[model samples]
Target: MKAPRVAVIGGGLGGLSAAALLARGGCAVTLFERSKHLGGRGQTSDVEGFRFNLGAHALYQGGAGMRVLGELGVKPAGGMPGAGSYLLSGGRLHTMPRGLVSLLTTDALGLPGKLELAKLLAGLGRVDLAPLANITTRDWVEQHLSNADARAFILALVRVMTYCADVDAMSAQSAVAQLQAKPAVLYVDGGWSTLVSELETRARDAGTRLELSARVSAVLLADTGARVRGVRLADGTEHAADAVVVAGGPGDIAALLPADALLAHDAARAVPVMAATLELGLSRLPRPDALFALGTDGPWYASVHSAVAKLAPEGGAMVHVMQYLGGRGPEASEARLEEVMDALQPGWRTSVVARRYRPSLLVSHWLPTAETGGLRGRPSVEVPHVPGLYRVGDWVGPEGLLAEASFASAESVARALVPGQQVASRRAVGR
Candidate 1:
């Protein structure tokens, strides 16, 4: 018997991971993507001297995240700076406060401020967050952070990095995840795109039909109650499948599914995020030992991943600085990016070589629920809403960091195919 035919939409990490797993399990999987590329937001690009990371600035693979990769036999390399971060506070670049002793001794914060931070950090795990889940990050910080100095110096540093979020609208659960657990900032080695490429390659090699440039518009159901029939693409091509995982965006899925079924889904609320990447001449660099820091002044927020010694040519180095903009993104993000570039490195006219960016591509995506269960009553990734149609993505809900969540959600969707389906048939072929 032929394996069940599964249609995996969106070529991003999650979709690719699901397709790979299903194909390997003996299901004939076809992966579709609307973009010309496969990585979705998980992508990379090259300019004059800099290589830009599209999305997912970092990943936390300390526990469950790491376990998921192990289950998929995926290994990753470090993507962020290793030593740590330097902060631009009060017009000066200071070393980041690490331990309790360091926090207390730092002149940036007052003695009382340090004490407050001490109390806060000590109670990190015990803090009641549910009441604060719907509140914004700014509100959370102002309410709980008692020390002004710590608020400005330490918390603000995190704020700039969007620990709370660019708009400060992120839930306490979202921000608390960073402060509570592993507390380590990291990136995939060789950039995040490497991981996406790995998943795509592995899945395609495993008998999966990876389809790019395909757009899925809706899932059509038959007369049978709760029975999912197949999906209809935007271009009018219909692909039949035993089970479908709506792993795109929750808001989008909610809009596509019948209103009756959508009652169970919370309308995905996503904030905006805009970023900029600049490629410059290595000669303009201040040297490797010069610590990377972000100024509170205009648009620049985060900076790292400059392997001056490795990628720079002769005496010139390349660096990519990312600035996240919130609210009314597209135009505002581009405008701020331009403003930040001109302000941060005013010497660009003389010291820089070339810079490239897509101003209009700026996207404001939805945030994931604090936990998988945070959705409370949302449908399962394996369980279809209108019977045969399922859902996936951060909007639907992310496992954690988007990349990992995408993979997890997609896999869950793939495994949901019913018994005797092609997927089941293939799995039982040799057994």
Candidate 2:
């Protein structure tokens, strides 16, 4: 039997995962990446003995990403951040309430607010979130809680979890599902590049050809424009393939298939989630106790990731301060994030070993909104009217969020391409 040749675009997590899985499933796979480096947003940089991810990043313990990595036999080493965190409200930092003792002792919320919050938290697991897909987080909060402080606190938590500051536009169902997915997250050592390296190695070992710096100009289709024939590179080189998977943002996909109405429509509906971040490698943290803080009155987050992950040298600290942007100008957003740094680490400027400020960073390609039916509303893996053409990315799948969504979409594409073959059994047969 002739093996089906598959071409994967964008060498990020999703592309790499799909390439490896499909190759293992008796398909000839070739992955093309525009950049010299892989990982896309997952790439990490090192400066002055400190490793910095593009922004604050964590892996949900039981999410689709972890499951996919496990299936690929890749184990990432990291540590979970401690529960000791603070809430910034009214220009004051208060110990975040975690358990029963802290809930009673914390001054962040009043007695009534605390009781209401506790009750809400207790019942989060049992709540049927499927019906809440069309409800916004703001509406959900307003309808469920009367205490102002509790309402604000819950909104802040949702922002931190989903990294989307537009609570009025975000879907409550997606927010609640993310919150209920076990709050434990791992901060990877050596940053997310660890996962990238592992996936790349596996892809290569599985006989999948990876072409770096290969910019795909267009996804070539047959004369009828109904099926994928191959991909054309920027250099005018064309590679023939039986299938092509586009693993990138909506803009990338739309640009490739400019005449496709479905791609155009999906691109118009995509809402980007952006953030301003200031990452620093400090000589030492001035206020070590203020390791993690979330703003209750604003969209701000500060975390010392090096405390849990080995991202810095001995005694050095790596801090990431971010402000989830909600239609705010980049200049103002950057200033607000700097203010958060000032509050969390007083006199931090003096101890700065290295620093990078990104005014506008794309946190996610699409913000799961109420109008779109939350996560389930995203586009499917197969491209409509274009057989053998698929899409995989953070914004394409119905399951998971962020990197998890990327992995989930990639897994779906792999399963669709080769239905009955398992990764282990197929690999044993050898490419």
Candidate 3:
């Protein structure tokens, strides 16, 4: 039989990952991206001599995505994890817990909060691995710490990082993994976009075909239920393929799916209101050393600047600040930063040589089932009775995250296709 032709829609990490893996598997893969470039919300912008990561306030090497990168031969960009954060309270900036010493005396949390957090973290770190698909981040955090302060700290951070406006909507299982994490958030020396750019290069070198500005409108299957016939593009062109993976957002998959198979899709709406407001300029220059400060402390504002020296002839350091505001309504979000900008630094607002903002998927419904959150009417693992189509998302991972969840979900789909030895030899692939 001829090798399958796989068409991956959406240029996000999940889609790119699927395409890369399928290509490595010897399948003829065609990746379609609607944007001019890959990397979904992962895009970074350079304005007036400044570079800014629009999403992901902070990321480190120890996350699921980092693990996947290691397997793919990518290394962390820079040195030790960037400086940590603190909560603002009573006009004084109070350091939040970053390690054993800080945890014992951090002012933002009480003794009870710290002890409970320690218990949860230690317990989760010790517990046997379980499938993460069935748990929500909220449940996990509550289970471990149960302290209002700790929960707020963790959930608010997740809200900003994951674009989750509805903090309570995340998975307990996913939450458990995050809170237990080691503090080694990593970024490429240049920026996170460079990582995606690297993946694209490596993938193409490995024989993957990338088609940007192209959107896959539909994943069509023949009546035989044995093979995926092809994908229908937005332009109405049909490209034939033997297999198809919906690595785009699960919602995108549910939309293209056939009516008969629609029931097979989960109706969980992830309510993550995400926003990234980046301001770039040579407004603040500091010594080429660790300079950490709270926007005022408290969970409300936190920031870090990776100084760029000799970056320009004048030698002014670049500043890229990331701000996340909960779903306070669009009008409110529009004014949040402006109102706070002057309060933080009086003259920097004018120094903002360039500013760009794009916020989407602000909210996504978590899975709607006891297995996921607490909702009903969820999709089955293999798409009900359908044969050629499969879904991958945070909800599908053995556990989910940028790297682990996406990788697990994609591998699960790949294995279900390759068949046999799934249990004896799980077809796990590092995302």
Candidate 4:
């Protein structure tokens, strides 16, 4: 049988993973990336001997990202953030109540609040999430926890876990699942670009032809408009393919399709999760003890990522401060993130060797809303009414969140394209 020719649009993790898997499954794969570089948001920048990811990037140990990377023979190495995290409330830092000891001793919450939070944490994993799929996180928190401090603390933690501030719109089931998953995460050494490099090497080794700087202008369809013929480049060049996988955000995919397509209409309605971030590379830390902090009074987070990853020089530091944007403007959000940095790392301005302030960053393509029924409500990999056309991205999957969802969606599309191929079993990849 002649091998099917597959053309992949976008060169992010999802696109690279799909291309590699398809090639390994006996398909001839060609991957197109619009930018001169691959890795989309996964790309990292190195300045003054400090490597910085686009924002704070972490791989959840229990999520699909690790599992898929393991199957792909890619092992990401980094250190886990220690348990000594702080909670900022009333302009003071308190030990974050994570385990039993902290729960009992931390002054972040009162005795009643601590006990209530402890009970909720203990029962979180065992809770029946199906019934809560349609419930918003705000509604769930309001109905379940009576202690104000406990309620505020859990909401803050949810923001850290989900990178979302819209609790009133976020699905409770999705938030709970994130909390229940293994709490450990890895800040990849050298930045997230390491993972991108690994995936790129694997894709090329598996016989995928990567075409960087190649822009896909549109998804070409047959005369009946029922099947994907291939893709047309921005320069008027066209390549034939048996299948095409668009691995990008909703808007990117929507722009390539006809305005009348249902997928395009749905994409227009999808809401993005956004954030404001400040990344700094410092010559030295002003307050080394203040390594991590999350705000209970607002949607803010600060972490010394270099402490857990090899992103800085021997004695230097790399800190990331972020504000999960709800309805705040870019200027306001950036100011809040700066305030968070000042509160967490005093005198950080003097030690900074490099600094970057991103007023707005698209953290995720879609916010899993209660109205949409959470993760299960996301679009399927297969494009309805269009055979041989597929979509893969963080917003087009039913499992995991963030990069995990991207990997999961890619695997799903690859399996659908090559039905007989078996994905490699997950291996024990070194951290």
Q: Model 1: per-residue lDDT, tens digit, 373-426?
A: 232223456553466666666433334434445555555565566332232111
Q: Which pairs in model 4 have colliding backbones?
A: none
Encode model 3's per-residue lDDT on 84-109: one tens digit a residue.
34454444445756667888887777
Candidate 2 regions off by >4 Å? 327-331, 423-431
TM-score of each: 0.78, 0.95, 0.77, 0.96
Name the regions of candidate 4 deviating beyond 4 angstroms. 327-331, 424-431
Candidate 1: regions farther than 4 A off: 63-66, 128-131, 157-168, 251-284, 294-300, 308-318, 327-351, 357-364, 368-384, 414-431
RMSD of each: 6.2, 4.0, 5.0, 3.0
Q: Candidate 4 at residue 371, lDDT?
A: 92
Pairs clashing within candidate 2: none
Give per-residue CA lDDT, model 4, range 288-381, as digits (tens). 8889999998888899998989999999999999888873323336667777878788788899899998978989999989899888788889
Sorting all predicted structures by TM-score, with the top scorer first, yields: 4, 2, 1, 3
Q: Over the full model, what C-alpha lDDT does candidate 3 score relative to the true structure?
A: 0.54
